[model samples]
Target: MPLYQNREFTTLMTLKNSRLRIFLASCILLLGACASNDELDSQANAAEQQIYSEAQKYLRSKNYDMAIKALQQLESRYPFGKYAEQAQLEIIYAHYGAYEPEAAIEAANRFIRLHPQHPSIDYAFYMKGLAAYSGNSNIFSRFLPTSESSRDTKHIEEAFTEFAQLLARFPESEYGADARARMVHLRNLLARHEIDVANYYFRRGAYLAAVNRGRYVIENYQGSTAMADALAVMAHGYLLLDMPELAQTSIDTLKVNYPDHPSLSDSGEFDVAQVDEADQSWINKVSLGLFDPPQPPQFNYEP
Candidate 1:
């Protein structure tokens, strides 16, 4: 070989060796950086798991406030961690256990919105309905024997709708049977609420309004336990409105379906003459129920 060619070949070999060394060094640095990242991720996951375990302990002890706080911290600190979604779901149960129904419902809703395809999404829906159902009772009602059917129907209706949605979307869910049972109770409560309003209107001589409420119950709540009372209210309202045919129809239906109802006489006649006497005299109104006190008429049905 010629001398100049030999020197050129030696220079080319040196340049290629330097380039390969730099490439190997770059790959080593990248692998080290990747290892460091993996270590940090493992540490973060361990911390998240620790917080979640603590939260679970709190929940098992029924210390719902602490459980909620710890769960919130875990969710916020490790938003993408493996435990984050589980923390969000348990937050709902913590709130529910604390008897904070509105908070539970809100948390459940947030979980549903954030993790629509989560495997436990049915649990969120079930909890939402259960929270609403529990919210129907106030602090006073918790201690007292107040009737839930007489209270505002807002929470009751909301719970019913939520349970219905759960049934529609997760028909085979483990919570389906419980949700269905609660729905049946809610349906009866709603029907009884309509009957209560009808009785109220009837007592105040708003016969047409009473009739409308009774008709609403009959149309929408046919199979409920309140059906007997609804029929009685309808019969009384029709009688007051001077619609004998309608009254007779209502009475006949009551006789066939609810023969043992209190509103029915032993001879199968409609026995609600006292309801007609519910109108208050002007003196009774002026006396604030002191003199000639008006008796509030009631649907005579076994509660």
Candidate 2:
């Protein structure tokens, strides 16, 4: 135990103590960093929850525009948050509530693509179909004397297809029953639209075109109410085309199915005399029914 040996031992002890202090300080700094991260995460989650709550409140209040804004903010801020998917789903409803059908459809489509396995996927599809169905109507049509069956049926057909897909994929969905009911209405509308087109062609002396349209309705929309009108069109067109046997077949079928159809006489026969009398004069045909007008044949039942 000399003085130099004692001093060396003391220096070694001091160095060891300094190194231990540095190690402990590093550990403390790391722990503080982790705690800060946890706090920040908690704050972020709280903010996300707050935004989601506000969105829900807006939705419950039927303030769709504000709900959409809040939902969009939540999604943009925390795309991977717990409420992100729910926010996306609610955005579709918000747009629909705002009467923005195309936007709702697009949002629903986006949700379907992004979260294909989401539990609410069926809801997305249902909303998409509903949006398309709503898109077929407008404020004007509600007030004005408009014939929806006479307008372009592209949107209506799209809605029908959308609902069909929903039923095919999610047969037990809660929305299935309503979707089915809407589909029946849409199918009838489509059939009537085809019959209206046939009637148009028949009025313009396009008997062959009218017959083709009627045949299309019969082949595609068999169980529809338009079947009787389709048969009448086919019968009248066949008579005009000099196919007496085909005309007779259609007339007989119409007689059995729709005996009280307008084109039928009191004796339960197709009124050939009325159809023959409906032929337009040359002047009327040239004028497109504008001048020298003649009563055109109407194969559709008015009742």
TM-score of each: 0.74, 0.76
Candidate 1 regions with alpha-carbon error over 4 angstroms? 1-43, 273-303
Error of 2 at 292 (Å): 48
- Candidate 2 lDDT by residue in tens digits, 1-303: 799999999999999999999999999999999999999998998898899889989988989899999999999999998888888888988888777889989999999999999776888888887778668777565446555666778888888899899999999987788778777767777877777777688789899998898899899988876777778889999998999999999999989988877778999878855542322110011112211111111132122
**What digit string (tens of lDDT, one per residue) describes model 1 on residues 8-91?**
999999999999999999999999999999999879877877898899789879898999999999988989877778888888
Scored against the true structure, residue 92 in model 2 reaches a CA lDDT of 89
What's model 2's lDDT at 21? 100
Candidate 1 Cα lDDT to native = 0.80
Off by over 4 Å in 2: 142-145, 235-251, 260-303
Poorest 10 consecutive residues by lDDT, candidate 1:
278-287
